[model samples]
Target chain A: MGILGVILAVTNLVVVVCMHISFRQYGKYKEHMILGVTLSEEQVKDDEIQCLLEKYRKSFRKYIIIGYITGILVIIPFEWYVSIALILYLVWMFGYIFLIQHIYVKYHKKLYAIKKQKGYTYGKIVNEITIDTKLSYAKDKMPVSPGWFLPSMLVFLIPLSNKGVREFILSNLQMSCVFIGVIVLVKASYLLIYYMFAKQRSQVYSGNSDINIACNRVTKRGYSIVFVVASFFDSISFFMLLWDEIAMGSMTMVGVLLFVVMQCIIVMGMVVGLIQIKKKRESILAEDSQERVVDEDEFWATGFYRNPMDNRLLVPDRQSDMNMTLNMAKPSAWIWTAGIGIGTAVLLLWTSVVMLRLDFVPVTYQVADKFEIIAPSYSKTIEFDEIQWVTLLDEFPDIKASKQNGAATDEYALGRFHIRNEGTCYLYIYHGYSPVLELQLNDMKIYCNSREDGVIQECYQQLQEKLSE
Target chain B: MIFHLNMSSETPIYVQLRNQIVLGIGRGDLLPGEALPTVRQLAEDIGVNNMTVNKAYQILKSEGYIEIDRRHGAKVAKHQKDDKEFEVYLKDKMELAAAEAKAHGIELTQFMDYCREAFGVNEEA
Candidate 1:
């Protein structure tokens, strides 16, 4: 099941990636930048920036395709080796994204300021091009590279470092096992510290003009410590691994698995984050170029585009941009929230299957069966307004009267009322039953279990993107 | 000697360079018609963007502190011959000196004594 699950995950990722590439290529071919942006067309006179961006984007697409193809190609012949290679490749790309971007972004503005002082006319052009390539690199953070160094390095050193001693220590079996445990704890803490710093940084950036970002300075000390501490733990693990009889354990195996999975998630989170930073920088540059001079608030206002001609505002109807920004701002928040939601649903689904296998719960409930059942759509809808809740309760009263799941009622002084009706129910209606042991006539496919769960996931993803912005 | 600039100072490099050039003229460190550094050379020497040095040179030219020729680099302007302009310059210098002494908490009598000493005039009699 785990193998199948991994296969399915890879397949889904491939499909999503292909879709993204096609969409971007189509966008490029069409020469279609995003709409509702208020940038003056003249600000992009040279299109050197756009051309540079497109070049990187094309390369990114090619690499992504090649990486996936290689993963599949290699895996068919050599499963374990290829799997490890693919994981390592992804890890390397992720680290490359972070480190390279930090360097580029840190130096970009200073370089531009120098250019401006030299009477170089196209400061905006250089800045925009810098931003776009960074974005492209970020999106392609997981493209496979040649496998010789990737897995070997990941096994020994963390993805970002290539120090010989560190590599030796990391790959040591006993040290690696201990390092695995340390990594899990460090990563979990990293997520928290990253969240706090990101939130604080965003607030500071979004606040006032006098508060310059100091151009890629280490704004968050705690997050830096977390990263450093993780590396330190890796060093300790390397030393520990030097000892025999320490590397082989059920706990060690679990820790290694957990570390790999968490790292993968972190890579995904960072990709999402970089995309967001790219988006923010793009919009900010566009806005900056359009305006002759900007005050503080103008710097912070990024969502809507202003018309250069009539000075009319064009706001996007969709909330996708907001979601994208939020996700970029605090990807771990989105990851954790979405993970919890999806995890719970998946767990419940599995538990249901398990109960049937163990004869703990009946395969099907009869109409008269008086077992407590949870109604779908209980969690998704906003419970803020009393009237909305009342209306929901009025629509379905049977589940409302039950004591389980705490169907709370709220009526505001303004005469609005909300009553939760789906949290508790005494009876469930089942139309048919299928025996598990017998061969099923048609495959039992899962549909949307509940709109609330589905919507929450979407909202979480959207919120993640929004916060990143 | 032509004035030189220190670029790495937190103060605007151009302002520092400009002040130094002005002081060079006032202190006779730069003689009349002395050749100054070319904008490019000055920029390189100070480790500043060329535009900053150019801006300072432009200001110096406008103030008649220096002049530039197509073939030659910037040069200090010849010493002023107009009596009215020289009188105004001397008054401005004296005012500036008085302000400096006041800033240093020196009394008017001490300031006069310092001025007399600078002029080699003894007040013993």
Candidate 2:
């Protein structure tokens, strides 16, 4: 098998292992404690929570085992389609996660019912915990400073370092960096806003806000560290692309591997942070005797937060400290959900369109009143009146340029580019095709080539005739 | 000051924003010449369309509740308590309130008392 195939297999295996660990952790922490009352216990024999946990654990194990086996079997037989198989495995993994979450939510509702029937306490009963609105809404009190996001700007320096680096970045790496940076910034901003505006829940036992503050701090730092690490990784990848020793394909494999590794690290960090927070919360609860229990009737139906009275769209999940759940009762929540769903669909469609264009779309040129060049992802028309001169060259021009809107490959360069001398130009050139046609327009330049030299000569002769007319 | 906009309310968002700003001014929560968040910032904070916020700002500016400038995007305008236009508008609103109260069989004293309470008038004084 090739190195790429091996790398894909290894990454898949790593992902599977990570998934297994995560599922096991979820099973272990299935029982949640609120207000010093552990309503459900997994160790208790024949209890509802334990029974439900066992069922989910068994189902999860069965699916994961089957998925792993199938993945290995497919990869072994159809090694050529390893990439496709890997994607399928990822989809299966996501499906498994969703199935487990559904099961958890279902059983959690049952647990809630049991707690309610047993007259268990949940939130604070006393109204003594007065919120200091000023302190709570203080944006300056955010655990991490905004300056931390500044490091992301360092990515711009990659292009300015050298000419080859600049070319590589503008052609290949700039778009990727922008996409990654935007995602990081969005995530960081959302976290900051959530931390700032989310209603601070009082500790059931005591009015001490220290634990709440500490928990928020931990979560903020944990999330920020992940985003910062991601930005750093993107910068590193850009630098790696500059190295002439590494092939682009191998570099892509390396990037994928790095991404998987980064994900694993983030997961581990979050799990550790959550565990520490849970421990601190428990310790705080043990020290206090006074308990306040509020009716959890709003969350009884689905074990999911659904309160028409609440206006917030994103709320901290009751099931996990590290995750956010949408408040299904609000219209804004629905709007956000729909927006995200549509955005994801659009992204998938755009990716498919790019792929289809690269594989199926042909590069076509026409010569009538104007010279028209059409290529995948980019198309241009050069008017006869704007043409200053038209010449056919036997070799490619030595121009320092940056790609703006089209594809660039070793075999062909078909795109809109910002050439050194010619401000913005359209290029449709095939390396093997001889007699490249260069048109110097009044404002910009146009360079084109074809599979046959005769086609270029005919186009040139046609352009001359049109110009004369 | 934090702007709390009710998305589920029958009132439009721009109207709600305007009413809230007016209420804030009445409550002395927003001071004259105090800068409000830019339209873009407030829109993002409330997760609403920017045009909704812009409309609110526009109404506020036209009514002399706030002023918009090129340098400082938007700010609460200086209080003009004796403006002729405002007096006419208040008289029209009060007439409507009086007619509604009369239709509901509310006495003038009770209606005035309610108005006094809403306006934060000190009865003892």
Candidate 3:
């Protein structure tokens, strides 16, 4: 391939890789943000809340590692042939955003609707000691959906994929960053928008009845901005790439660098948003926790806590996901996030190095060269047509394929694989460049290369062994 | 002691907390002049809003069930010669429960029997 082609190819690979990383990061960010919104301070105190946090954290950690590893394994050789995998991954990315994420969000809304239909939720009982009647606001009703900002942010992933104009820029470190920097100009605009809405909606959500409406509007507006900005970034980045020579000029480079700096600022803005939400959640919960202090006349007069709408706004009396924890007083959460973040960064850096090595090294020099392997027959187009799973089933019930990172060495390609069987079970194996598969029939270890001869020979050998066993 | 709060119950959490404390006092679970839990502690105990326990304590203080001093914490109040309200309160509680039980189609004997079973009473009359 020509130098420009190589650069374009590599840039695309890098951008997609970065986008994937960012996508995962955004997922975690959204997860935490949603949790931030949904979880009250009282809920935080609850063991269930802690469990869910840990659960999300664990899932986030697992997916990050899996994705990174998969990217390394899948992209190294595929970087040469990235156009195909890139297209596939983009399709999958869009599918996940529109299909999976959308469905989950819809389910959440449905559940919330059901709960709202029910007059009151019977919250859990908390503590074995110090039972108090007047202080208990457990029966106070709250809506299942906290508001709109969360859901909007969540579904932005779909539109983001649809607007792929910035894909090139987002992938190209030099140009993509310039696109992000240009968005800094819009921050003032975003703030202005936020200010306008905040002013207009200041008194809108004074009570429980306003929660759904207020939260909905806020989230929708917030999400709309996010999508709009993403679209801008996409197109602007593409345009910058179009005018590369001029864009790469000294003056343009300076602009590009500034844009990069602005992108960093945007990242910082996300961090600020995260912190503000957390602070708001904590303060609201703290205020709710002190609900028992209402005077006697106020208690019976308005029947505030007792009223269904009022109850939803009141603090829960049970051990919910939101509760104040003794541990919360300590700076442990920050320390934990920092520690894990550092560890994750280190892991990514290490994997990136490994992937770079894999990508740069010639295929002949790899461990494949070490094995005195005969070249596979280029013409032996064995399609594996014996009632194979992929073709026989209209939709394979449980066959799932995920990008495997580095689960196995270069000799045996490996990383992360996800398999889901929605219906009937059918066994199917992915045929890849250097296949390292442990078959189950008689438990045989089989290794094969993309070369037709090598694969067939290995298959025959495995079949012979299985027959003997 | 394990404190329970029923958020849905008509009884306010503070009243429940107070009632539990009084029961604890009568059962000799708490001694005279013993420090009861602080407002924060009581709030944490029942998992209800802290203000609920605080409200209960304020009422308890007025009724002389407990005394709150910053240095000493909430202590079981000293006994007084005039326990008139205590008897009236006890009678009122029994009457209300009995009336509710009767409304639920339970005879007085049946209600007493249910209470005995519930409390695992082995005391001879």
For residue A195, model 3's alpha carbon misses the true position, in angstroms, by 29
Model 1 Cα lDDT, one tens digit per residue, A1-469: 2332254345435443533443343223111122111122343233554454455456556655655564444334223232343344444434434443343333333333333344434212210101111111122112222232223224434432646444434434353455557656654554544333332211112222222222122222323333334444443443333221123321233443444454444444444544454455435434442222211111122332222211112211211221212321234545765887699668655644432332222222111112111332121212121111111111122221211221211100011111132121222211121111110112111111111223323433433343344
Please identify which of the two predictions, 1 or 2, would achieve the higher lDDT against the true structure: 2
lDDT of 2 by residue, A201-274 (tens): 31222333344344444444554555455555544544444342123422344565565555456545556656
Candidates 1 and 2 compared by DockQ, better number: 2
The B-chain TM-score of model 1 reads: 0.68
Against the native chain B, each candidate's TM-score is 0.68, 0.90, 0.64
Error of 2 at A293 (Å): 7.9
DockQ-better candidate, 2 vs 3: 3
Those runs of model 1 whose alpha carbons end farther than 4 Å from true positions after fitting are A1-59, A76-120, A124-248, A251-256, A277-469, B1-125
Give per-model CA RMSD.
27.2, 12.0, 22.8
Candidate 3 lDDT, tens digit per residue, A1-469?
Answer: 3232333344444444443443343223231122212222343445543454555556555544554454344434443533344444444444433442343334334333333344323232222232322222221111222232333234423334543434433434444355446544444354444433232211111123223233333333443444345434434443343344223321243344444444444444444443444344444434442222211111212211222212222232111111111222235544655787698668656655554444333222012211222221111112122212111111213233322222222232333232222211112222343333232212212123332335534544544443344
- Candidate 2 positional error at B58, Å: 31
Question: The CA-based lDDT of model 1 is what?
Answer: 0.38
- Top candidate on lDDT is 2
**Candidate 2 global TM-score:** 0.55
**Candidate 2: TM of chain A?**
0.63
**Candidate 1 DockQ score?**
0.01
Please give the C-alpha DockQ score of model 3. 0.09
